[model samples]
Target: MTATESARPGKRGGTGRGTGTGAEAPRLAGVPLLGSLLDLTSDSLGTYLRARGEHGDVVRITAGPPGLRTELHCVFSAEGVQQVLASQAANFRKDNAVYQEVRDSFGNGLLTSQDEDYLRQRRLVQPLFTKRRVDGYAGAVAAETASTLAGWDRAPDGVVDVSDAMMELALRAVARILFGTDVDTTVDVVDRCFPVITRYVLRRGYSPANFPRSWPTPGNRRAAAALDELYGVCDEIIARRRRDLAATGATGATGSGTDTDTGATTAAAAGTAPGAVTAPGAAPGEDLLSLLAAATSADDAEFDDTELREQVLIFLLAGHETTATSLSFSLHLLARHPELQDRARAEIAAVLGGRTPGAADLDRLPYLTQVLKEAMRLYPAAPVMGRRSVDAAEIDGHAVPAGADVILAPWVTHRHPRYWPDPERFDPDRFTPEAEAARPRYAWFPFGGGPRACIGQHFSMLESVIALAMILREYTFEAVDTEIAVSAGITLTTTGPARCRIRRVDA
Candidate 1:
């Protein structure tokens, strides 16, 4: 049973403000030497929830041993979440080990850059994500989803892996939008290589010490090979974009994978950039890659060829993976609940009525949007996000040391009994405007919070809403895999196929 709504872990303040005075955060001790390492990595969702339930909103988890131990300050309260991510965002920077590894692999794009560098990058790229701008990409989402539904039509016994389907749909849609028609070579390279690279990052990120990349160990050699391929393809693509920009002189930004090992720099025979993109695509120089390559700062600064590659990689990773996670989980959740599925499908059919969804359709289909939001609340794309405390800070009166690692677990926060009744239950009604207005802002921050929030949020919403609305409307899906077991890496990857059985609504 949940505690009363007013029964907070401790004294609480308004949004982003924690009420207690200076004190030590409750320490969570675990297995000898490894501390909480085994419990956390094995099942972080359960671990974080148990920690909050036993200790309070603010718990300290120390992992590793002696001089090599890492102290993690876990903040679970909505108020503390706001404090760490919004009001006191300046006190927390993206200097965590996992993030550094990300920057090393994906480059210092908006997701990792901080301070002045972040501000300049934000300024240059923010305009491209505004609602008006993102709305223009709906065609890409619809086209890709239409293709996904068609592929599902060929599935044997009406069974399809929605997880793989959503992942492919999101990657292809974002990639097409980003690179336009000339990106046939990127999709496959990214799809194959991202997993190899991220797995290495997750392993190295949590270790107390690591062998240098220059070492020719098995892991190092494999990662280096993946990096070489990934970097070479993206570098070629960047070079190609620069060449194109110099010729036609237009500007902006672009994701997804391809099927061939052909490099992205060179177009296929007939000078056509070949791959799988077959939709109403963007005009010349209007694709996201072109825009980012052409973007100039207020001070007239622009991303160098290297910086452009970095930002491009980040866009592809952050844009498609998170959106795909949300979409997959959303469909899986609805499949498990027939009533909710019917309600959402009815909403889609009433609004979309077999016509392709448009950017304007986002508003006209509010109930379906709520369904997506509900799914996200249960399984956030970024289940666990990390930050580093830059200075001593007070949260609910507990003092955090400078340079300590801080964790803002949205997966746990979204389940706070104070805000969510029957926290584990799937209920889209919890997201109605009236219900949303009643809660604190940070109570459900899946896209993160504060100024450093994911810049592609609008793009994500557009893609998810359009895709889900379309998928649900066209097909009647029943859950084949009722339980979704997930393990977190860079994003929440389902442990299995996350399968569902789909039949045409007309049948």
Candidate 2:
């Protein structure tokens, strides 16, 4: 994967731009225009490595006909990401080609919105993710994990796809905390609906045209039905909560159960609590939804139900899939390298001495955390982040014009030899506090950076730490697959089943 081997011999020449020293940037001149374009859609990382090896960190690609204008592709250093994500950040906008499709399904959520809308939505949702609120939900997160794990077949002969299992686990856990404690009961419904929508998004970037109602495309029909069912479910829950508020003037919703109501009814039920909390039948604790429903900007503006639903759905995907992918991959890595897993377990034992991890325990479980960090560094779930240039600007001194897409990939960045020492190796100690402090800010961005960084990052980390610790404490995992192969879709995932054998830990 080194630059010299990847760069084509004759296609090497210096592009007089950026800070690159006289090294020639990789170019594929004789290849048909279609071939280059196909390479972009088909093998982005391969294209990036060639460019990086030839041109240094930042390299540009021309993917189409000369008359049509070439697409701009830049794979710069961590410092470049910092520059783009910071000081000159306003020049970069999130309206990318792939994300346009995501926005159609997710609506104007924080992840999709730009400018004023982005600022407003971020403000409302930020408070709910405060350290205190996140910590408060830890017990509930653990309880849900335990509940899910309780159902697993722990016998030696039983093999499970830990990736899929963790995806289901994460989806249910986040849904319960955000929507209601009983949301896990609907994981099957989510599984049924989400795949259809995600597949549609993957296929059809971001088009608004509705499919023919008569069209029997199973995916399309399923997506439409799932959307309707999800809305119906949310409305019904909201309505029930409203009814409960009318019957009994209550404010506190204990973590024991769920309240089904339309959001309006939930608000009505909450009434005039000092902090503007949700009704008794609302979610168990103050979740992201409740916070949005309760928030008002300095100007006293609030997000409507549509806005709330969009944001909630965005979190539904973000809060679950990406982290779950990382978790599943980490487990895959642990299975492949049992000695590494053993080292992590020994560290966990020395730190906690046979007890479930608390908030404080996260700091003590440094190696386990490092392992997770290394796993993500290599196999980032959300591999590619794209931003379209709204204003013509310079990215690492290359003239990037308006309307062109700019992509920064963690998949490439994490593997870049300049930043990552022995990039391909699965070494967790590299993420030690001292090691991290020595690296540039953007060198390790598993959850991304800037104002747009994933808000549920803390939530994801807490979930991962707890889940990994619990699994390590109870069982030992070994890989059954010959070699792990990754596929890129909505997130980076195993090409096939991530099968693993589990053996119970004996006292």
Candidate 3:
């Protein structure tokens, strides 16, 4: 929830458990020893969809051998998801193995930190993502997107792998925002190093036997090398930022990577500013990195050097990858559906013809917003969210054991027949304000809910809306390589190219 929303749980049911009398979740059949390992490792989306189709809302999936199996209690019902994420959130913890891998690689920052650590980090970092501050970064997003469109215009035959393009676009945009004046130092995260580290985390996190990361195995060694390079780069940038602030005798850890502090500071790449980057809608501040460096908790506590590095790492990792997935898939969906594309573009033209989009225009382009929401519902970035049950609980009348690894999958829940009619159809109207209001809160949660929801919610929406508006206005897209495969990584990533042919409206 945003800082503006009330923390009160809306209305409560008698038991809040669904229409059953509390029995163990039905299991999907699997091989004797291996269980569902092959199915999951090969096609996680298909497996989850099939399980939800065969078994009802909650299904227990056991994978691996007898001695070391991984059991996942999948909750695909919107009500059950609400119970896990919002109502009984305290009963579900982020103590899963994959999260541990995140802590090891990125340090115990907000993404991997639990309970009090998470609360403290949230207290210190929440202000940076306030609506006003993030809206201010729309200029930076526009600037970066302009460069991307230029590249697309210059591409041979006007053909491009939009998946790859968006990955580059999102990485550069987020990097520039994260380390404003020193953005060039963040190049390592964009191209070479970060992928290796994430791949290693995915592999080791899912392996039945997670050998110690310190082992001399080839994967571990390679991962270690990548981690060192990433940590060193972040540390260098943070240290330099602190030094610059100290040298200049400035207060609040070098005001947001650029000029004055009152507005969202013309914060872009190290040198994208040519004017006062005024964010006309909300309150304003500097770039997130500087704000993070300068922030103090309620008790006057501040993040230490290492702590600062951890927060920056989490920001970069989470912010960049997830937003890219949303943009890439949105473009893909719009490309394939020309009727929907025109409808959205018509709304965009009506609202923001010549002027660039700002946070204020968000409410004006309702169709475009629905299109984006529909894309997110189809392919949520974090498809399967893992949480361990803190105590034995009854969900949808299913008895969940304590310490069980539970999953809340937006990929499945967004498509639940109960909540979503014509589940496979890509209908933007499903997200119309009225329709959304009629559904359960968790029915279409692209960004997970409750207090632990993504703190970067406003920032993500700001960046995505600005980029999508500009791109849709500038060019028309045709799906070139129409079909693609997807898999679950740190986020949902395309395993193959999603190529699109561009027809620039101006050219």
Candidate 4:
């Protein structure tokens, strides 16, 4: 069957279970004992693609040596994705080995939390990401983007590592918006340790060997050290924010003297120590840290310091890393396709007339938004979402046994020919209202879907759009490498530094 025909929502064509028909899913045969773990560790995206190609949308992949101790049901079809992420989400949960790995580092933060705790934390955090709250962050996003570009201008070489640059920019942006304090001490520590921790965790998670994090293994030690540093940083930031709130007698609510009615931080409350680049109009309580610190659940249950640290650390890491990856990939794509870059630049120029973009300008920059959407479609930041079946569940009429790992891969679904034609092409127009309206909801879920979807989705999109506009406004990027190579871990990122030659655009 053709890729197009096979990818249809309910089409069944492979050596696997019949789509929409009750049948046992086909299992991939691998070497005795190891199963497909080696293939997965080496090239996860390639493995999934090959599995879906050969075994159909839903395939059972066994892992573990000889005993086949673990089985993962890889779901590629939109129908199956909806089943796992939405329709039958109650039957799937985050308490799986994959999330346990995340929890080992992040604790019971929103991403790794399950059940009642998840719902309570979600409610407490949801208000902070509302459209109004996210818009308040636009100034910091633009300021940091412009500041980073200025530094690049003074660099000895015109060549820049787009990946590192984006990561730093995103880190600073998120720090400024979330911390509202001179978190340089914390940011510096996080910047140094974040990569080490993520890389170590990814390797351990994918490895067939289930090494206990408590083990004295070299990788575990390094990851533990990084986690310690991160925890220390979170502690310092939380303590400082508490001190600031106490000094001002602000409960972090409106009219608290630390923040305006709009929740913008006051200069004194913003913790602008010498050399600190504070976000203008920001207040002490305006940031997420302060809000979280002062927040209470419906029952008035407050988060203790450790819980607070977990949430803050997770946000700092997740907020920056995911957006940075997306921005790097977006820049790489634009550099590779100069025509699209020019078109995006033209749209930015027409909309802002060279002024730095603000949250208000976002609605007007449809093409730039489309460019970002398209880039994410091609290289989704969170390539795969995993859940464990709480009980036996039916996905596309195929029975998924309890305790099985349910994998929904955006990387595969986004490129499925039934949902996206000429899927490999860089076509921003594919995100046009008409085209998007024509596809199923799960066809391109870069930010995921359902109640458990990314809480920072709005924040991420706004930050990326602002950053892309600011960068494109100031510079025209030229690809220095013939090809851009990417690697997937906790998030999808470029394998190495994405090198690009930067040229200042004429005003």
Candidate that scores best on lDDT: 1
Candidate 2 Cα RMSD (Å): 8.2
Instruction: Compose the digit string of candidate 4's lDDT tens values, residues 95-179.
Output: 5554566678878887778888887777666666667666777777777876898788775578988888998998888888777
Ranking by lDDT: 1, 3, 4, 2
lDDT of each residue in 1-507, candidate 2, tens digit only: 000001111111222233322333344442664335556556656666566766677666666444443445464678767766675678667665456667766677877788888876766666666554565555545556666667666534668788778888788777766666447545666777777777677655422234654578886677778787766665555444445544554433222113222222322211222223222223433444454455555553666667767776777767788878878888988999999999998987787565556555567788999999998988888776666555656666555555655667778888888778788888888898999998888998877788667777877887788778877877788899847777566677566888888877763
User: TM-score for model 4?
Assistant: 0.89
RMSD to the true structure for each prediction, in A, is 8.0, 8.2, 6.3, 6.3
Which residues of candidate 1, in runs, are more than 4 Å off? 1-21, 251-280, 298-300
Model-by-model lDDT, in order? 0.76, 0.64, 0.75, 0.74
TM-score of each: 0.90, 0.82, 0.90, 0.89
Stretches off by above 4 angstroms in model 4 are 1-21, 208-211, 253-261, 264-278
Clashing pairs in 4: 33-65, 33-66, 264-283, 265-282, 265-283, 266-283
Deviation (Å) of 468 in candidate 2: 0.6
Report the lDDT of model 3 for residue 148.
82
Model 4: lDDT to the true structure: 0.74
